[model samples]
Target: MSQTSTAFRGVERLVAGQQTADGAGVRLTRVLTQNLQRRLDPFLMLDAFRNENPDDYIGGFPDHPHRGFETITYMLAGRMRHHDSAGNQGLLGPGGMQWMVAGSGLIHSELPEQESGLMEGFQLWLNLPAADKMMAPNYRDVPSAAIPEYTSASGVHVRVIAGESHGTVGAVQRPVTEPLYLDIHLLAGSRFEQAIPAGHNAFAYVYRGRAEIAGTAVDDRQMAILANDGAAGVVIEAPVDSRLILVAGHPLDEPIAQYGPFVMNTAEQIEQTLRDYRDGKFEAAVVQAL
Candidate 1:
């Protein structure tokens, strides 16, 4: 467990609007600032995109390129048709997760099915270590049934996405440092506690209800970053119907070079990623971008 209490910046709220690039979906919310990055390392951005209108979603994400990082998509409401350059294909529905590691390179696209009602999900990016950054690409598609859920002694129901905590191990074995991704739902007047690694950075993203983190009040629709200064495990005294995401991961001390949809080690690498895309060298996945 950590030694200090969690002191996090409250969730940064965003209103997602329609700004179609390669995908037909809209970005409902996003975490994209230095303030947000300080607490969430290894992980870069969090974007929640959804489209209820079939016409709107049919456009989908055309073939695109990615390298140097991983993309995790957790479907909350509808179905998405995914295809990649590696000949990967699937239809992911609610509770399904697609963890794609774009090491040296990979190209893929996701398009919502016409019959699916509301298409909602989150896409998270995780950086790879220098040694593994250029390794072969990989993919893991976890169906909803495969994801394990459990109720803690304290009555906090959790869905494990990756890593482990609260006595439940996320089925997907994460390749990076010890990480914890838990979807925590707490009852009223309940206290939630879990042992986190001593030096990992932790945070809670509240999707509903209200809660208090180390005496700090966090209401619904807010995200709280746990203090990084070697703090003890987190304690949440939450109100009823409180839904939050608890995540903790070891910090990567390497420098970050990010551009658009790719993250790498150096500025030159960022330039190379863009150059590769423009040069058509990374278009092996899905239908290549027009």
Candidate 2:
């Protein structure tokens, strides 16, 4: 039997992501923008991209600099090649994930490895705490086979990417943020429930098909921000074959200052980051590959 929660969190509100383009004109939806950073603490941004036309994603993301945050790229289709100034390189294909920490700073590029095909994925920016903002950069490439997955008793297929689900541990875990990232697939009339710490902020993003989250209808491409109403967990039901990502994380409750790709706790830090990049400091920083 699937685990159950006596009290389930409800949807606080629905967000229709803004359509935007970035990284050499690649089109995507900015789901978690700057305005929601504080509301969804520790999670800076979430960009969803899906395209079939080569023209839409041909240019790809050229060299860019980032600092004071970590980026997680989860690919559902196609292939992307990652290269960084610290001599780190990896290829992320369907069902693979790439996690990179731009602790101090780094220059990197993500380019398409295929000429024509469907390119779909999500890039989530997770903020680093002030104390660890200047730590050494780190990178990890988790292939599809590396991610832990299981099927619940109710036929809900789950992929544990960054936290525990049911009894299965995810591929990665962070002590500070304690993020829970689950890719859930539910067949028609299926129900799934997962316990969440009452203190953590949570939300769900429906990527395919539709589902009802805590009695609120969540359609495809919509994000439902779960209320922090002292609920013990969340409950989801699907009327059709639907897939979604459930994400919850402990809030840092710290000030956030961001300038383009750089995020810091203060404006002075942001200024220092600019000078560091201009002095070519990022190129000299060593990257520890995990």
TM-score of the candidate numbered 1? 0.84
lDDT of 2 at 92: 98
lDDT of 2 at 170: 95
Clashes of 1: 12
What TM-scores do the predictions have? 0.84, 0.98
Evaluate all candidate structures by whole-model CA lDDT and list the values in order: 0.71, 0.93
Task: Summarize candidate 1's per-residue lDDT along 1-290 as a digit string, tens digits.
Answer: 33234542232332122333335444455642434554567777666555666665567787777888888888888888888887778888898998888887878888776575787767777778888887777787889999889887778888998887655679676666566777788998877776666677666767678888777778755567676555457777786668777777777878888776677889999888888788776665332221
Regions of candidate 1 where Cα sits further than 4 Å from its true position:
1-22, 32-35, 50-58, 285-290
Best of the candidates, TM-score? 2
Question: Candidate 1 vs. truth: CA RMSD?
Answer: 4.5
The true-versus-predicted C-alpha distance at residue 4 of model 1, in Å, is 14
